[model samples]
Target: MEDKKRVGIWIRVSTDMQVKDDSPEHHERRARYYVESRDWQVEEVYRLEAVSGKTVMNHPEAQRMLQDLRSGRITGLVFSKLARLARSTKELLEFAEIFRREGADLVSLAEQIDTSTPAGRLFFTIVAAMAEWEREEISSRVAASVPIRAKMGKPLGGQASFGYKWHDKNIVIDEKEAPVRKLMYEIFLDCQRKKTTAERLNDLGHRTRNGSRFSDTTVDRLLRDTTAKGQRLANHTKSVGEGKQWITKPQQEWVIVPCAAIISVELWEKCNAILEEQLSKRARKGRISEYLLAGYVKCTCGTSMYVFSTAKKFTCKNCKNNVKVADMDEIYQQVLKGYLNDIEPKMYVEELEKAIAEKEYLLTTSTKKRAQLRKKMDDLVPLRVSGDLDKEHFAAIYQPIVAQVHQLDKSIPELQAQIDFERIQLNSTDHVLKEAKGLYESWTKMLFPEKRAIIETITEYITVGQDTIDVGILHLSPSSKLTSQHQFMGSWKLPT
Candidate 1:
């Protein structure tokens, strides 16, 4: 009598509807039945409830199952489908490699992919390649549309620059922030110092859009941005690699859209020239890592907190409230862990997928309808030429067909553009999910720059109060109206 094969079940459903309709228990039961048919003993079940399939390798349940497979606790993993295992081709390949190295098998019931056999292995490879190809096609389409959208002055994706707002697809100078932005240039010209300008702005009670005090870095960035001089540059930067580090695109590829200038071009040049001269005079030093929460930390008194050169604490100049640097960092790390854990990727992914599907369906039907109309128009043209139809009859029938075809011609591209936008959004969500997975576990090992990038991407602002700390997290979806705030007790005493 041969010993039965041991396998672990993997279950991940991404939405409440999925949980209700195609429940994890149902998936597990089906997998168990499949395992019974193969005489495989079910050893463990790994459930990733409401978790995304974007990147599961770093997920806790995924790690547990991988551990079992490696340790010979289970000889195989059975999931409902390949997507339930992972949507990312790279991750799917990684899982396959691990399974091969560990002498284990992967069985996805939906695709009938059983890696215990040579044919199954080949099938898995083909499917993974197809998935990769599909992802690349979507990405290519989105990238191609970007320049077209940018050239047309369409609001690409992100928020407009600090002093401007996007209204009705047009960039306009913000009424309240415009004066403050213009004042930044004037102050910089008079003082010739970014720090002094920031100090003056803070003194005058001018805060950033998030209501945080301006820093020298913020002042420098605002002054250097060409948007203030009327030419708002778009498609000038691209995110590179897994870290999503942004790098400048070539100048030739940049699309410059003219907008209302916040300040005179002469004044902008003069301020920038002074900055250039100062930069040239200064000794070039290695870039220093800024505080983890620089411009983000705010006081309850509605003032921004700063860490001075002589102090080891974040202090509010207005209220003199302070917390030790180490303590604040520890608190932030804890808050970050909670925030990442609470994120529900399904909610955002579901909405994007729904929108994309609707647009794609509309595009397909419209395209077919347009073809039919064009054929009718073409058939009428021949009849009119042969005198089978009178001129008035041809005009009545052919003109309506031409108009319908024309309307679809206009609408099809719009539908595709909308689909492209949703695809881009879905890609972005996947990137965020991948970055977030195992972030808390790997936080301590990350470099200063990497940690800073995550903070800037996810955090809106952090408020330090006398008895509490409030962290305002940025929305996962652009359309999300919900603001996430995590409050922690400030029981830790400040230094005397």
Candidate 2:
């Protein structure tokens, strides 16, 4: 046994995977059978039951396999299918690189990929295309079904949120969550008058599930939530161009069972009217003057400079440089055009595509890492419970790990939110590229600011220097201003 070569078997089944009697155990036995038949040591069976093998990001066994490979512990990975290994083609390629670097081979029984054979490599190529196509197909089907589901007032799937409870496969009247729901409606209604309802709620001792005090935006989001009124499930949908929608799909959808309604549809509509009325009032507050080099440009004075929207003019209060509110849009148009003119648009798009891939990777990996850490912490709890250490000693050691876990847990949701937002922005990347091929399209064709708003939201100002320009972004401090993503490139120069 000591002289025998080591092998690891990985299995992943999605939550939706049908089970017959002891299917997982059966898979385990089959994996064992395969490993035992080989002249290899069955070192470990990393079983990821009820997990999605499609994504390495959230898959535990996949992460463990990669770790082992990096450590040069294992030389083999066997899975039932290629899809049981990874979902994204990019991820599959990434796995291939990892395997190739570590002198490991991927063995997919169903796909008959041995990684050592030419035929196996060819199988991999076919699998990659199939995996990509399957992913896109699933996404498109979900997207198309959303509008129909929203129209049907079905419960889109989600956990029983703070104020809801599971009743007969559907979330029903949770009295504890009911008051918060009512408060949300009232807050939405009162926000029109700047009523500070969230502050009031906090004073009244209403906390979120995480025991956090509420802000106005949180209150507003809750008020607009269709789930509170039993009009829709707790799932998300694309709300673009015109109307908002929710989606539901049989068992996949959030159970949209009747719960005691916190507010009526009529009342919800009234709340929306209040939001609209307040929005109009805010609109009357005056134009939002955006700057061209807002995020990536910095000031010479070494202060955090930004385009301050005043009634009279858009001014850099720190540097005291005045940019007329009317001229700001034209300047941004110039800046974007200048970027395209200076750099190749095709090249820039390619760079952006790479960036999107990297960002998505980072996001997914973070989620996976957080889950792994939390799993560790959950496992450790039993040791602590068994009087492994005194309370003080336990606190001294475990507190930081627990805190870090909490931070990661919080981060996952925020990262998911950002991903959701960016997905919306990048949905029309090809269209945006097409638009760029033509002359700079007019801004303000839509009420919402698009590219300029995004740039300004991220940047502070571009700093002019003899050699390079510094792009500053959302800088609150002097040091932060210098270090922002404001790139100083060889081809680019800042405005004097």
Candidate 3:
């Protein structure tokens, strides 16, 4: 084991690792010095560039080194600094354990530490903690910076998205994609007229970026997205829960560069409003019955019970339960009305309005922070002229601070756009509530079969128990599995 000639060299560079100065050359020279002093023959040097030192697993070079260790090919691993290998103490200890188990040594030239020593392990614990802190500080510093550039209508990311071209200061609209965007709006109108949807367009044959056939999801994204018109997407809020993701309509969150506008803002808003209106109507009317939750309810078998009536028998084909259509319909209607009465939609709207106002308040705080960061960065200009602070420190402090200002710059505008989006939704929700209020009275007067159609449109699935029923209403639009269905619990025995 002592006579083993296999050796591994791992090299990593964050953006600053390689400089015009002797920093990188010094790192290489020191590494080579140790290799020459010891008779360890050069096997493989894994060099990773433009990567961060914050994550040990993510770095390509580190991954390669670990792979060689697992393969029993590496007798030893060498780095200049412990930070070059890991950012966290926990991760450093993991590597230490791996090397110890493999009968291999982990050594750093700068720290003069090796895994063979108990002292080296202690040194690593301290180095890893510092590295972790530095990584987190850099992250917060970056988060504080991006909005300023976005606010100025400057291109922050490397390139533009699908429908726009990146210019020096702003993104120009791509004329070719703009027409296809307009077509998306027209298609939604056609769907309303035919009482059909873009789902057919997908089935017929259309392919998107992934080479998969077009789906209703693709059409839905196009209709809801504001970006296709060469405008920024509004209220692009992202939330992750239970390892699931949800991306909603582009609320009013946008940084519209006057120079970047390709489609009129009015036109963009009009397209979305039209599409939303048509979808809501279709989802309610399109279902077979007014059972609001028709598609939503699942049988014990996990299959959906079909909402169908043949002659006087209402049956779940999967469950084989023959129910009276009139009785089931009445039960579903009563369940829905009961749940709506509990909600007090008007009160819900008021709560949402207050929440939006708080976000707008945060926007002001963000704007003030940006002003401070910008003013501080400007004060550094005099230091740059007089040489009080050298150019290097100036850049280190100023560059990151400037990025902070840019990020702050975009935050408030994005928040304001969100407030606008929520306002629109609040209004729509109020209107929808008004519509829901009349449902019970309207349902009683309609024909049993006609009422059935209305029930299926609003209800996703109708689940019947011995003396109880679960009616799920399709609160969201129809042509979408994206609809919101509120489950209404009710007993067939009416309240005295």
Best by TM-score: 1
Candidate 2 residue lDDT tens string, 172-221: 76787688778767765765443487788888888876788887777777
lDDT per residue for candidate 3 within 1-54, as digits (tens), equals 576456777777777675422245445544554654455665777777766656
Q: Comparing 2 and 3 by TM-score, which wins?
A: 3
Across residues 1-496, which tens digit of lDDT does each residue of candidate 1 receive? 9988989988887874263225576567667766765667999999887787788889888899888887899999988778888888778877876776576888876665676644455655665566557667877889999999999999989888898998999999899899999999999999999999999999999999999999999999999999999989999998753235699999999999898999999999999999899889896889675688888888889898888756678999887888777777887888788777877777767877888798788888887887777777777888999999999988888887778866765556545445544554465565566557678999999999888988887787788887677777766554553344545545567433
Error of 2 at 23 (Å): 39
Q: Ranking under lDDT, best-scoring first?
A: 1, 3, 2
Better of 1 and 2 by TM-score: 1
TM values, all candidates: 0.42, 0.32, 0.33
Once superposed on the true structure, which residue ranges of model 3 sit more than 4 Å away at CA?
Answer: 1-311, 316-320, 386-397, 409-421, 445-457, 474-496
Angstrom error of the Cα, residue 109, model 3: value is: 55
Q: Give the worst 10-residue stretch by lDDT in candidate 3.
A: 476-485
Every candidate's lDDT: 0.79, 0.58, 0.59
Best by the lDDT measure = 1
Candidate 1 vs. true structure, TM-score: 0.42
